[model samples]
Target: MNKALLMCLLILPGHAIALVIDSSKPIEISANMVVIDERKNISTYIGKASITQGSLILNAEIIQLFSNQQSVIKIIAKGTHKQLAHYQQNQPNQSRFIEARALNITYLIEQELVHLKGKAHLVQGFDSFSGGTLDYDIKNDKIITSMSKDGTQRVRFKIKL
Candidate 1:
């Protein structure tokens, strides 16, 4: 809730976006209700939760923060089928920003990884990716996607030169 507490929770090993300016900017979170459990080191935000910092923004119906020893270890955001959780961050010195959306999004800060499931979609500049599941390795700049087991959903990509 407080600035110091939010900053401490976000200053992890690898940032979601490698934006220098974004980190310097303050983080802002908005939601209908927030529940913090100090003993469990977990914080939950219910009802149209949104977090913003500089050019970065994340929105979901429910957002949960998991921390260990005052440092954030993981973050999970969930949304309904009609309105998927969304994440966006501006690229350094670029007009276009990277965007992602899914029914559920899991961010592993220390590992520098992001998992997107249920109608996952990611877009950067003019390139785009969509699938049933998407695993993004932030540190390695690699992405792995898969189709649904029932074969109803398939992987799709659109890249522009």
Candidate 2:
């Protein structure tokens, strides 16, 4: 399989992390269009899907969620999707720990991994990283980001404490 394809599969719903809350019901979504396939246990929101989970916020032009199984198995996102993963640290101030964006994104619940393709970018406070493609293992807190190796292009980043 292609690297991009592998990354996508790794981040699909059933492949990522165990759900912290199973009773969490679906909330209302306002978008241009929405479709739910009960037979497949899949829900698709298009033309802008905004999902909020506690401090986490996600925005995507299209989002496909698999919810039929005991666990959420796969998530396919496309078109300018952005994610903000926030939390409260030891400090008094709330922290936006991580923000990410991509043309397409996928999360595998069982694998606890996230894959971002096409102009992927990630920001964490003063530190920021960007690449043509990215793969993040959320459970292990590992990230692999890369750009085309050709000499005609350049990839730049900035990090500050």
lDDT of 1 by residue, 21-76 (tens): 67667667788887877678777888999878788788999988787764667889
Model 1 has an lDDT value of 0.78
Give the TM-scores of the predictions, in the order they appear.
Answer: 0.84, 0.68
Please give the lDDT score at residue 74 for candidate 2.
72
lDDT digits (tens) for residues 1-161 of candidate 2: 55533332333333222334322433333457767665776767777676554334557888777864554577777774254221111111215455677877787766867787777777655667778777766667677888855533235477786
Top TM-score prediction, candidate number: 1
* Model 2 root-mean-square deviation: 9.3
